[model samples]
Target: MSWSMSLTSFPSRIQTHPTIHLLRPIKPTISSPPKFPNLPTIRSVQGNFDHSPITPAKTRWETMLETAASLYPLYVTAGAVVACLKPSTFAWFVKRGPASYSLSLGFIMLAMGLTLELRDLLNLFVQRPFSILFGCAAQYTIMPAFGAIISKSLGLSPALSVGLILLGCCPGGTASNVVTLIARGDVPLSIVMTVCTTLGAVFLTPLLTKILAGTYVPVDAVKLSISTLQVVVAPILLGSYLQRTFPAAVKFVLPSAPLFAVLASSLLACSVFSENVVRFKSSIIGASLASDLSPVLCAKAILSGELGVIILSVFLLHFAGFFVGYLSAAIGGFREPQRRAISIEVGMQNSSLGVVLATSHFTSPMVAVPPAMSAVIMNIMGSSLGFFWRFINPSDSKDSPKVDDK
Candidate 1:
């Protein structure tokens, strides 16, 4: 019944197969990763390798998945373009209404949970509480504030402003974990920060949205809290529990989880994009505040000035999050790797969660647009930053030890 015993009980196929490869390493390790209690032996993500033998077909399959996952931003971009041009393709995901978005988001969170080790997250916190907590605080404080400022400066429509702020208030996205790995940063630090901020979002997201975005529309904080629990907390907890209880089963599917999550995330955002495009085509761009959705864009809205403003706002919001996040982490005296981890964790957000909350709760189609847009923009920005850091040298202070390059 013990965790280790359960892990040891993995079927021989899994024991021999090494069923996952989440990253293509910046530098592959010589030997298979050591089984550190605090670390999962993901080959590239943690700077380790799986020297275990496997069939050629399995290797090719994993390579394709890894390549696909690495190009996640492109997939998101393509999905958005498709949503803009052929909105009908994504109509099925929205056929069930907002409930569909929530379900898709829940499934993605579950996938994220299954990939995680609860014990590792806990031990990470016990050992490095300040860095994680500081990063979480910045995630809440910095981005939400940026959302407010940018919207005001850009004079975004009320619905769009709310969408932007809500996007900011949501927790760090699960995507940051992979980006952190690519950046050659402290993957454990990034993962722990993400977990902390997400749990915290159940409270902070609603409260902050109420404060920053309340003027634009009435925010029922209580309803928001309950929804967050249902769509976000519940699935993550269930997935983590499943991961612990059925390690082998989870392991069997781990190889494909990230790729699946990537596609699902793209679909969710594209669903919103298509919905807003429909709303725009129906001449609903400037609907009254009480109406269903104050539409932000149409099929041709990409050429419109308002769409330009929305893109600029989203870009500025994330750019500031990345900039301020790194500067703050450096100020906090973290090393280069930890700084990059904190920077990424603060910069990228759970924008899909933002999209769901905006669509499910807010009436304005425009309210969902910012977060949907964010889902695309943040990934592009984060991935670029990760690669930029990855190519550079990360030199810690002479006295201090190098942070978890494992």
Candidate 2:
């Protein structure tokens, strides 16, 4: 957010002094640590003045792109509807199977990595190891446990239960970083928490899912671990490596990365929904017909059945995660912003990872549904919570940089 004057280009027809070409390349400076420093890392280095000044036209285009990328929840919801009504619309993506799922999800991880600096991740951990570790531990323990309880209490089907549990066992989502910014929370902590939990998920996700979901169905922990390594860890590390190794190229592509992630996540979720459309339809139809009622009442009856159960179970899982995550953070004596960051991080799972994992390792399509629904539901919830926090805490409305001081 800082700027420095530098020499600029002239018309080729004009001769320039030798000193004119010696202008130094500007390094972008972040405003402050927790005020979403990395956010602009993915955006253009507008401060780099060795080139032509930014045009209003280009700024408008970039704004349009950013707006499209930020409406992630709407995109996911619309994709789900389209998939349900016209399954064939997403058949191409589904027909490709694991290859498709892995690629889509992997790209998202890569994009996230590009937005990071490995050194920053390390600095954050060194600065606040306890806060980050506590959040990560809660992420693994609280959600998975609550997921199991909710599924059982709701009396969901075996496959649906595994889906909910798997969703919980996964890591904090990238969307949480963005939500934290909106909530005026500790953006730096949110980013670090997401990265740590995602990387840790290579081990924890498989182990936890195997333990909690094992009751509903057999789980091969080894296979789950391998799948996670391939689909999650590898892509993220590769992206980080590329960012460090090729800074110029990374900068060039950074603006497009977020849009790509948004599209890929939306497409992947909808494809899964389309792939499992038959099961969804059958479940709904059967549930609707359970009362043996007239066709006019079938629509309402559907919500009272298996589909309803899955929806309710998934909703309860996230709701409890948000509430419990906050309560735990407050009890730990963390400040307000840190609590918001932890709450959002814990409440929103990497549902895309869950969808990919379920499809790759589990035979049941129903096992993928809860995560698919989560893709639609969690964003709405996260955004609403962010708005609520931002408005209620007037003193914290602007992202305060004091997050790192603690």
Candidate 3:
């Protein structure tokens, strides 16, 4: 079950289907000068393909794809903000159907699978098994336990506490790979950690949530396990199969996959927000910390109560994860880039999956709030951290080459 990413670029040149036109570099052609030196005829041939028929379209297509990829964070932020302002727009995306959230999650997972190849994964594990293992361990260990501590320390409500715990117990997100690349971190380590945690989530998410959140409410680990399998595992495996069997199609879709996943996640987050908008509005203004708590605890409680305990709980969970994850990795003797990767991976939970699971399993809309809010908060926080890290040089260049999953 080991894995590695292929060096080959997506939308590979292996086009098997007819009627699918791929843009390829046109070979350079050397033309002879005019036969007669006296009367020179100028041919409109350009070496840079300006004269080629397909150049404009190809350039435009490539630019569009690049733009989408570059603005992923912006798109996600805008979607969440807009959904908060007017939930109706995104609410419609979910209203049309049964399994809307599940289907959207499945689509995101499929896109992730298309980007992965078994050969690439195997190469990665063969080269750096320890880094991957440490990252996965951190994701499962640091985040979940810290989440419970934060929730309890804040004294969150039952639904909000459970939501925070679920957010923590969930796996690393696919988005972490994108952030790692932006941060110039260990992309391979990030991807491998994400893959490992996601697969492990079938057991870990439910088991941890039950253990941590069981105090808040009765949790059914078996039910959560089945739901996770249905949404996460099946689609990802099917997508991997399709990638191997129908690479041409996968290639066609690969360029758009990440952006598509972002959009899908945003929509899912917004929908959850919309469904609980009324409760959300009321909850935000409802409570505050009393004199019974310590000064530090009282300050956090005040923020949580005023801002809606769910948002504050989720924020503290991810913020603590980012800080502690990096500190722990640095202490473990990992280089800066590896520490960055571990931090982002640990901080960004599969929030969409959290939203989906909460919506499907819990009766309370409040339960889904933390994850939905996390979808907005984590990206902004992760992106900011990534950009900050991008300017700093890694401690060792050797660490960079060994963990480059790209």
Q: Give the winner by TM-score.
A: 2
Give the per-residue lDDT digits (tens) of candidate 1, residues 1-406: 0011011111222142233457565554455644547734333322211122233344777677767877779988999888877899987888976898888899888887787677767765776677777889899999999999999998999999999999999999888988987888877777788888888888999999999999999999998999899888888889889988998998788778878888888889988888877655444344323244435433334334566678889999999999999988877777777888888988899999998899889888889998998889999999999999888867534454333321
Per-residue lDDT, model 1, residue 13, is 23
Model 3 CA deviation exceeding 4 Å by range:
1-60, 96-98, 283-306, 396-406
Candidate 2 lDDT over residue span 164-195, tens digit each: 99999999998887788778776667788888
Give the range where candidate 1 is weakest over 10 consecutive residues by summed lDDT: 1-10
TM-score of each candidate structure, all chains considered together: 0.79, 0.81, 0.78
Tens-place lDDT digits, model 3, residues 252-363: 8776777777778877887877777655545433432253546665556555553556666777889988999988887777767788889999999999999989988988
List candidate 2 segments past 4 Å from native.
1-58, 282-299, 394-406
Higher-lDDT candidate of 1 and 3: 1
Clashes of each: 4, 0, 8
Which is the better candidate, 1 or 2, if ranked by TM-score? 2
Q: Find the candidate with the highest lDDT and give its number.
A: 2
Against the correct fold, how does model 2 do in TM-score?
0.81
Name the better of 2 and 3 by lDDT.
2
Instruction: Name the regions of candidate 1 deviating beyond 4 angstroms.
Output: 1-60, 278-304, 396-406
